[model samples]
Target: MDVIVETRYGKVLGREEEGVRTFLGIPYARAPQGERRFLPPEPVEPWTGVLDARAYGPICPQVANPLNPVDGFAQSEDCLRLCVYAPAEGTGHPVMVWIHGGAYVFGSGQSPWYDGRAFARDGVVLVTLNYRLGPLGFLHLAHLGGEAYASSGNAGILDQIAALTFVRDTIEAFGGDPNRVTVAGESAGAWSVGTLLVTEAARGLFQQAILQSGIPFQYRTPESAEWFTAQLLDALGLSPSSWRRLFDVPAADLVSAAARIPARDGLNLRPVLDGVTLTQSFWDALRDGHAAHVPTLAGSNREELMLWVARESEWRALSDEERIARVDRMWGPLTDRARDYYVDGRTGDELLTWLVRFASMRTFTYPTIRAAEIQSEYAPVYLYRFDYRPSRLGAAHALEIPFVFGTYAHPSARALIGERPTHADVSDAMHAAWVAFVRSGSPQAPNLPEWPTYDPKRRSTLIFDEAPRVEDDPDSAERELWSDMTSLSM
Candidate 1:
């Protein structure tokens, strides 16, 4: 049976399936089209009558192939929506809000893998949301105004904040606790969670955070963002005076133009360190103990760079000399130790994968661990390492998603987890651990070794596998390799 509940913003209807109630495609904010394309999200007007929220919302604009896009998903500019799933029949359950990640370019709440039905069954209200993406969601102009116009780069992030606001105001009516909320995500979503952690406006909205392989090194400063914007405008032959003309261009054209800007060598349209919404870089905020009081669960997979690195052979093969050039170009002359660790006489696909792994760790995992360390000092922080390798593919990026969700037999299971029974069991165990963590900040599951909260002393972390175990800091070697490298400014 479908149940309709009235929220502070509007009436939302959800259907019950397998003991879980799901409300899909609920608009948290109005569509960001026309003049609102690059601005903060506006509130969705309250509706008087029952609203049918049966189907998932349209995904944000993105290249279909996350790895290499030959053809992309169906495009649209009016995609701003959120979905909610809850186990409660009435009220008072902990809320878990999830942000899907596709490098701020792809994926949506609608993705089958992100289905929150399982989480709902675990006695939590799970919310998934979609935000503006790519150029349409992250463009900054030289119109030169104040906070409203000065830093318009992180429109996607602002949309997320609007979604949180909507939840804070309305989730209670949908059987969720407004004060007891946890914001969790992976990849770009993880990055978004980290961004929200430091955002002044986002403070007090969430009480706990969970980050899975969030890139901690991608913050672009205001100057860098502006420089990227100028480069983009120049490429399109649009004069500085014509900046306002962006309001009229088709959203697809803008995305295509932004896609052409090339993201290699540390240049891309990531969340900028605009002094407005984002006050400073993630590392700075973390080191300064900005989010000291908020409990955190953060970790990364053992082979975070393997999959991404494995595919590097296809990126226009280069010579030995060219390999060094490319690596230097990408990371800009690594330290002698760092250089030897990655490119010490290595060549061909092997060299490329090493270089890719080095870059990936530097870009994503290193910061993730560092943030965990910083947050651990202040709050109860739990750290983990997904080390279970599925036959052919090593413990790769995004490998933990299905495992955490516990959907090993789902349609996309084979593609996501490979066709193996051992993998399925591991996924189930990992999923249970996550469910436990959601229930309580610690990941203490039955039949598992005692998982300890992260601290500078032991530097311990739970390793998820068929035989899950708690290991004492797995990547200390690699982490120390880049410990002295300067953090990217927010």
Candidate 2:
């Protein structure tokens, strides 16, 4: 029997399996197509009949390789949907709204890695959503298109705000508590959560946040956004005057063109720091008390760059000269300082391994700590360093997703964890911490170690290894390397 629920917008049908009531592919906003392609999302109108929401919805337009699109959904521009996983036995459970990460290029709520059954079974209403990506979702048309397109650059983040609005207004019907919502994500999704912290429009939509391996680095400023916009327009062969042609061109063209525009680190076409949508100081937003009411759990993995850099043959084959030059660029005058600290100078896998460590920290880890230090002043914040190595990749980016969701047995996760044996104990502890945070404001899981709130002086961070434990200021020597530099972006 189909379970029917009436939301404020309309009645929808969902499926129930294994003690979880899952309502998939529910539209949060009208199809962002035609004139609305680059505009902010518009609310979905109320439908008269019961809507079929058993199947997952189409994901935003991107290059979805038919063989293995991680989102595991069809592609289209009319994609502004979310999936809700509510416990079969609950009426007022705390909500965890998960945002799937793909460097703002791909992935959707239907990502197999983001299965929410664990959260549902543990008495939390889990919501995962899809947002715009690449040129269609993030291209900056405001400067060329004028005031009408002022927000065109930030349409993706706006899509997220719209999804949060949907949750706030309608989550009650699905057995969730609107006032007790936690907005959580990993990687770009985690960056999006951090972005939402400063997004004035997104204020009060969520009460707590969980950022797992959220690379805290470069965000697109207006100047940078315009440069990216220029590149995309050129890729499409559209003159400045003919920018309007974007509406008529096929999304596939946009996707293909976006792939050609190389972005070594983040400024490809993700969320822009449009003064209208995002504030200037992204990290300071937490310190300034924009989200004083919200507590936070923020952390990065042990070797964040390894997962991405390991597969790139070009990166693997860098000469010592080229390697030193790249490090110089990343650290500037601090290059010698970094060289002295790194100490490992042999080439091949050894140098690359050490380089990965330096890049991950220089690019991601330091910024994360600085952000946490700022946020810790106003509200309670818990820090963590995920040290569980899944395969030789060594606890890299997105490795914690399956563990956080407790989807340990998923095929993709199996492939990622590989034949070297999986760790259910790590997954269980990590997943429980997430659940505990969602239910209460703290991540003090019953089975896990005592997790104290973070303070700048001590910098207590829970290490999620085979033996999960809390330590004060892990690797302080490496962290202090970037101390003099007030601002850092990879």
Q: CA lDDT of each candidate?
A: 0.77, 0.83
Error of 2 at 26 (Å): 0.4
Q: The CA-based lDDT of model 2 is what? A: 0.83
Model 2 TM-score relative to the real fold: 0.95
How well is each residue in 262-350 modelled by candidate 2, as lDDT tens digits?
76445577777677887666755665778676899989989988787765667767887676666556533336566776644567677
Clashes of each: 3, 0
Where does candidate 2 clash, by residue pair?
none
Off by over 4 Å in 2: 64-72, 326-334, 419-422, 486-490
Cα RMSD for candidates in order: 2.6, 2.2
Among all windows of 10 consecutive residues in model 2, the one with the lowest summed lDDT is: 64-73
